[model samples]
Target: MAEQRMPLPPLLLDGAEYHADPIRRALSALAGDRAGRFAPGDLAAAMGSDYTMTVTPGRASVPAPADGTGGVYLVESAAPVTLAVTPPHATRDRIDRLVAYVVPAQAGGTPGAWYLAVREGEPAASPVPPAVGAALVLYDLWVHSAASGRPIELSDMRLSGGQQMLAGGTLAGAERPATAPAGTVWTSTTTRQSWAYSGTAWRLLGVQDDTLASHALSGSRAWGPGVNEQAVDNLTFGPGRNGGLIELSAGVVHLSRPGRWALSMQAFSDDGTPGSSKVWLDWPGGPWLTRDLCDTRMRGGGFAGAGVLHQPISWTGVVTSDQALNAITIRGAFTPSTGGNRPSYMVWLYVDYLGR
Candidate 1:
């Protein structure tokens, strides 16, 4: 039953079942069936599978199939040869199942010991491929116009689920394809970045801003605005006093997203009397006010004199979504050291993303 089921040609049974004619017919018939065609198993061999004919470095050949559709090869070569073939024009094509491989030689690095499959003819080369200790396989299954032999499509199931994107060489040396079909996905064997080909070029996925922003302000406004203290008036601000994130008019810092921030402020008692300066922050609906429970000041005044002293105060915390940062505000205040001396201060704010 096994022999009967084996794709042995009737003529081959009379001859040798291992002959090229039988195997070629078997492969053609198998592919033909898979491709919606009929392949005559007895057609006379029109091409030689044995390496009797020498195919040189820059040569090509289209082994004549019994029905001019497809055929097999028993190549004896040192390098891997590129095989290509075109299918007859129809509404569709399905010859992609065709495959190719190199048989390992017991004694490596010798010519005329490997099989190079044939198709639409050649323009491919493999120069002294490194000695493969084990049997290796390579395949070329291009379905082209039966009439013009033009490429229509391709896929690589080995990578990203049959993507038309492919690179040549080892993973370290592989280069991205020059062009790819729409929706084709490629994972760089070199960088391991998953790039999706969007017809124009490869685009990275899940990328976020990796920039850090900070702003610092110092000096004094002759007429103080209000304490809790400075009102960031505008949407955009000079990096000196209010980084663009601070709103000068409403004293609010509107951030598009929640982030970790470092808020610090300093006040100096420059006059010959003791004075105090303070800073604090509040969200529209926050977990807590950013200041000591008893004291809401960023800087406590020092003993005023020729030795002017500046006090520094700071706070660190995570801004959460519920406490929409856009609704938050920062304020500062200054108290006179003596009779009519004005208070002076400085502040710095830094925001950074933590990927949360």
Candidate 2:
């Protein structure tokens, strides 16, 4: 979808009528553009004079920082305000509260009434500050019961506004943000993995680890054991062999992510015969009902029998579909000039994710 631009105010003509509402609308449009460009959070002040909280004997104060200077969120505290800390009770060890700048509801239909608010916490051994709803938090304070006139370490607890931050829990438990701007990132706390918003949905981030699955071969299966010999077969990963990243059935692979990927297969046998084999993703229906050979091997002169041939072949392509998952099948063909028994040993399949 194309991004919509905010409309600018029209140029004034000579002897034209001017209205206050048009000026206000222009200013609002500008502010809205700023809000869209930058994330909502605290902005730094000049000369290190910011909304840092300072604690006194019985009070906590913030220095007078100019309004519209500390943050791009278009809300600020114009004057310095101090709140009195509650006297600690003997039963409770500490009292906690959160200091924040809150934008309040308009009075008598007038707008832009922002003020400082203290979200108070209940007295407890280790008191936690209450949630600062619709407020930009500045500091979290904990007052001790026993210590009077004690030095309180005040750390600037404001969030930076320059970049979009990540938020999520486990892969299964955590719910992704219902709506996020494209390129936004979210980390799964349980898996320690990250996902990115792809304008439409959350896509897993980074190069995914290779998924490896092997299929054990049974008795002797010759590549070509007859005259005018040509054999075609599907290389498969055994049931339950999927690495949880992908799903496999026979030779078809099911991928959930929509992006570029690198897929590979290795078919090895003990019998080394004078034969040639080609592997590819099934496309244009060739001899094996598959075209576009990814890799091919020709074994001309080798001892026939008793060794593993670990020649891995790979193919790289982009997979996209209207459906959530994509399905691709792999097929291979072997042609031998003379009749030779090439007993199947094992088939190893790999799918490596590149990225979106």
Candidate 3:
């Protein structure tokens, strides 16, 4: 009878001729299937300490896989072992490779096995390092041509991994990766923002704070009870803060990104009068027509004359523009009578961005 070559689940038949090859192949294939679940360079957690190296001391510590278990293949070291590295080349640069390799069994008592070694490479401007068949490259030691006594620096080594979900450090807008696998996250140090790739494009993550367009009161200017005008202030722009999506001018906040925004304000009035003070927000030509007028009235006799009255009001609504620009106008006035009266006033307007 021809013997089965590939591995399969072991099964027995009554009074059937039995051999060791089929059983061994089945068990080995099962184990290989399990090991394949992990990436090529994944370090087995329970096996031993992660393959770590000390550059200055030129030492390396590696954990051997127990019996049949290993990162990619079994290792020869019976237990955790350390290896000393040879000194760097005096006149040429090279890469020292730490690798785990498998050796097939020989004809004698020698058995198939796995072993770890630090293979030194030929020195050159860009040297091609040696590689064993199916070996797991644990780390790369970049040795530059240096004086004989110089210590190895941290910048001269790199730990190898099967994959990286995150890049080493925060990146700038220009430094952001041009292409990344889906689900990879890139953070920006300059904007303190992050984006996640979705296989097609990068999308912003987390809440974005609204721009502080303006916050001030029309000082020294008294209104005629119902006097209202555009809230004005000296505009200051933060470099690259809003990505030009929002801008602040004399008294108007420009919203170039179409989305919902929470509009809020506080108005104050005190003019030896006994009436109510009011403030309201509006974006005349945009989707958000008007916000509720907030009012504050003097409480009692002691608070009637020359007493300050301030009230805060807020509204969350959507603003849209086909041209990607919307100008929000913040207006304030003192309406003492049910009709109209005049007085000095203070108004504070705040705009916060809410997502689409």
Return the TM-score for each candidate structure: 0.31, 0.32, 0.33
Q: CA shift at 311, candidate 2, in angstroms?
A: 2.9
Q: Between prediction 1 and prediction 2, which has the larger TM-score?
A: 2
The regions of model 2 sitting more than 4 angstroms off are 1-243, 283-291, 300-302, 305-309, 322-326, 342-345
Give the alpha carbon lDDT tens digit for every residue of 214-324 in model 1: 444433333332332454333234354332222234434544344565555554444443445554444556545542311233332344454355555565667664553
Score candidate 1 by lDDT.
Answer: 0.38
For residues 248-342, could you state the per-residue lDDT of candidate 3 as single tens digits? Answer: 56656766555676666666666654455455655556653333344445521233465566667777767654422546655555434334455
| Model 2 C-alpha lDDT per residue in residues 1-356, reported as the tens digit of each score | 99976464364756656643355445434443222212223332211123234332211112112322222233434344455555555555453444434232222333444455545567686677676544445555555554454433333454323222222222333555675655567765433446676557666555333333222211122443443322223444455443434444554555655666676766565555567655445534222224544556676455645233556667666766332254555545555546565445345566666656
Model 1 off-target regions past 4 Å?
A: 1-207, 212-220, 224-251, 266-269, 289-307
- In lDDT terms, which candidate is top? 3
Q: Give, for candidate 1, the lowest lDDT window spanning 10 residues.
A: 36-45
Cα error of candidate 1 at position 17, Å: 59
Query: Worst 10-residue stretch by lDDT in candidate 2?
Result: 56-65
